[model samples]
Target: MSNSGTPPRRLSTGGQPPIKFLLHYVVEQVPSRNGRTPCFTAWLREELASGQITTWNDEPIRVEDTRPEFAIQVYDTTTPPSQDSGGDVDQRLQALAKALHAETRGEREGPPGRDRDRIDVWGLPLSADLSDEERIATCKAHLLAEIAARDGGETEFPIERIGNSFTFGRALYIIDRPPSRWDEGEGGILELLWDVNPGYRAMMVHEFGEKYETYEYEPIVTRVTRAELGNQWLMMRHGASR
Candidate 1:
């Protein structure tokens, strides 16, 4: 997408105060052909150009527009007269730098280790043995149960059937809720992709936090490929059926 308005102003580190850098990205849709028909591919790009600081402490910090694709060293402290004297300042600067890095990189701070094993969505292994119809039924049932278990009950889960994709051999479902009802830092919605032929299931929960906005979901199963189902549908419709 084309940028509008003035480019952001560059950050100044002259004050020696800890800097908080905020990077914003615009989601753009670029036209491409999946086969014969034209489709739009969505991607994130830096929204501003001039706001980026190219060099800090004589070290090059690359910023493509506003995207933080490079490492940033934000801490600059000279040797203290005594080791213990500057300990507090060093620690504080380190923490601030870490936080800023996480924000710019759009990192999600969550519990370590994989959450996939805990995702027994349908109480059945989404194995290749199960039929497509059976998988779909199980997924729907699981979604219903999840909705009922939430705070707002079934009303909270506005399940939308996104239909089948013959190309990828999967059926999609979206559990959407209003932004108001969604708790801060909590995933507001769930998306399920059930492979029709292989019977493999992948699920993602959309999450948001104070510092960053991410389009990617927190996956229940790690190996499942992230996809834009809408784009996939367009591809399938345009004679790219798998």
Candidate 2:
């Protein structure tokens, strides 16, 4: 399975840069060569589950995505192996995802990311006496920062909402705070519904009992306190119609 740790650890070569590698996973549809031995998909998993992850110089490989027939994984043997920390961190998996990324055939990368997933977290500890507009400004500054992030965070693209589908990048959040529902100086919360479109390309995979095509319509939930929203909002800067 996948080994993304709690709060999902961020993997960038900050300090004591660890050895990095890439695991290209893809299970294509191909016929057996001899029509004899069982397909690698059947028994290959057994071996992987049995503590056999790699084959490159005996590199142990683990398959987690839907398909498990054919996978193309990669690694960089350039950097020397870092010291093991009592086996808590699997160097092998680390090698695969320490800084794992993807470079599709025709898609252009955003900045420092495209081949990987990036989370944008903003922390603000402003003065308590700031006005609501000032707080909104703080939130806006944070949103702008996130939009300009080198990795995959918020994008400059507008967040267009039509009925149920919201454009991938958020536009702006319309705050509807009920005045009678809260006391003065008391912080409130904003709940946003984000309909995420992974991309335009179509990926074929197995579903139910047959092959079904599905687009990435993953809806994610995010909570922002009035204190955290700062003075600004997460709305797109320009071209944000509706």
lDDT of each: 0.30, 0.29
What is the per-residue lDDT of model 1 for residues 1-242, given as tens digits with 9 covering 90 to 100?
33233233244577864333333323222111122111111112332244454567898643335322211111121223344344454343333333322232212212331110100111122444554455445555644443344435333113222223232343333222223433334332233433332211221112233223323322221111112322333432232433
Top candidate, metric lDDT: 1
TM-score of model 2 (CA atoms): 0.24
Q: TM-scores, in order shown?
A: 0.24, 0.24
TM-score of model number 1? 0.24
Worst 10 residues of 2 by lDDT: 37-46
- lDDT per residue for candidate 2 within 128-194, as digits (tens), equals 4655555555555454443344245432222122222223343223232322332234334333333
Candidate 1, run of 10 with poorest lDDT: 113-122
For model 2, what is the C-alpha lDDT against the true structure?
0.29
- Give the distance in Å from residue 25's predicted Cα in candidate 1 to where it truly belongs: 5.0
Task: Work out how many backbone clashes candidate 1 has.
Answer: 1
